[model samples]
Target: MSFAEEAWVPTTETECRIEGWSKETHQHGLQVRSSAEMNAQVVGILPAYVINFDSHNFGIEFQIIGSDRGWLKIRGAKDDPNRSKLPIRATYPGIGWIPGEQVAFMVQSGSGHQRPDAESAKLLDLKGDWLTSMGKIVRVVACSGEWVLLDYSLGRSRNPQTLALKRLTEAERRASQGRAWFRGVCAIQETSCETSWP
Candidate 1:
């Protein structure tokens, strides 16, 4: 489907790493499905892993190209971060698919979790310049099938855990650096962050 974007130039290639399926996957790891649908095919079994979520069972972050339905696609094989938290060790660059829904990218606007240079992205806005909203967090600007393009700040500020542990205000941890291509079906959008961490 064609979508008109009002934010920055949409990007497919990203320097930042994307995450998928978050669970206590210490058993036999997650299965890399051959196809997009469930029960498609267990092409491979990836060892359970964890990302930057502290204690959660997430795999290492890497260049996840895109997603289909609820799965994140790995462009090339990626391995879990070298460590014990990885449950089972899969060499480097393990190949597979991730359940997109399992990821919770809840970005809040006005919390430094929106566009890094939103004004610049607005300046780069191709169409709907007037409609360019740096408002309401990162609004869905465009979509290629299940992938929606938007800007977000990935930093300590975005993590609720850090907020409570560090006793920091969201404003202090803001780090919206650039845009990201995400499965629109799975984004957890938030405009007001009234729920502050205790």
Candidate 2:
């Protein structure tokens, strides 16, 4: 079920710094499954070689691509069941998060408005090098049993909604200190994917 995969790594200096992912890190031979479909089987499991912990939110920025449904659920913790899960629909490319609240993104819903578990939402107090680290993640749940974790990092130009908003240009924005939001998981390859906000 697993589909194509990618990764974000150091690149030559350029006007715009971008990242690319490839299967060189891990083999997508395994079927990609959604959090709902895989049940207990997919306990936030990740492959090796994806290192360079960010110490921020604790986990690597794992981007899952192919999926049958348009929606995906981001849980607070990998193993925690039925916790706070965010919805990432096509309308919102990158979903923002409040430091403490675990903003999990999803594409669709079954019944009433889907709400993440209250306990799962909380600010991540990551003591790291990058002071300005924000993100909006887009992911997909595929029928192949493999999922897509797209980590779209945001500029560290202050909280757009707050006075911290620095109003820096794309260049200045990229210059500001930034860090990935992931710490690494032991039992499985814990990943912290992201997307950008409007």
Which candidate tops TM-score?
1
Cα TM-score per model = 0.39, 0.20
Alpha carbon lDDT of each predicted model:
0.39, 0.25
**Candidate number of the best lDDT:** 1
Kindly report which residue stretches of model 1 are placed more than 4 angstroms away from their true locations once superposed. Answer: 1-26, 50-58, 77-82, 85-88, 91-95, 104-198
Count of residue pairs whose backbone atoms collide, per candidate: 11, 47
Candidate 2 lDDT over residue span 1-198, tens digit each: 011112222222111111112111332212223332433233332221222345212122223221222322322222111111222211112211111111133311111101112232212222221222343332211111121223333444445345364445687645532222232111122332343211
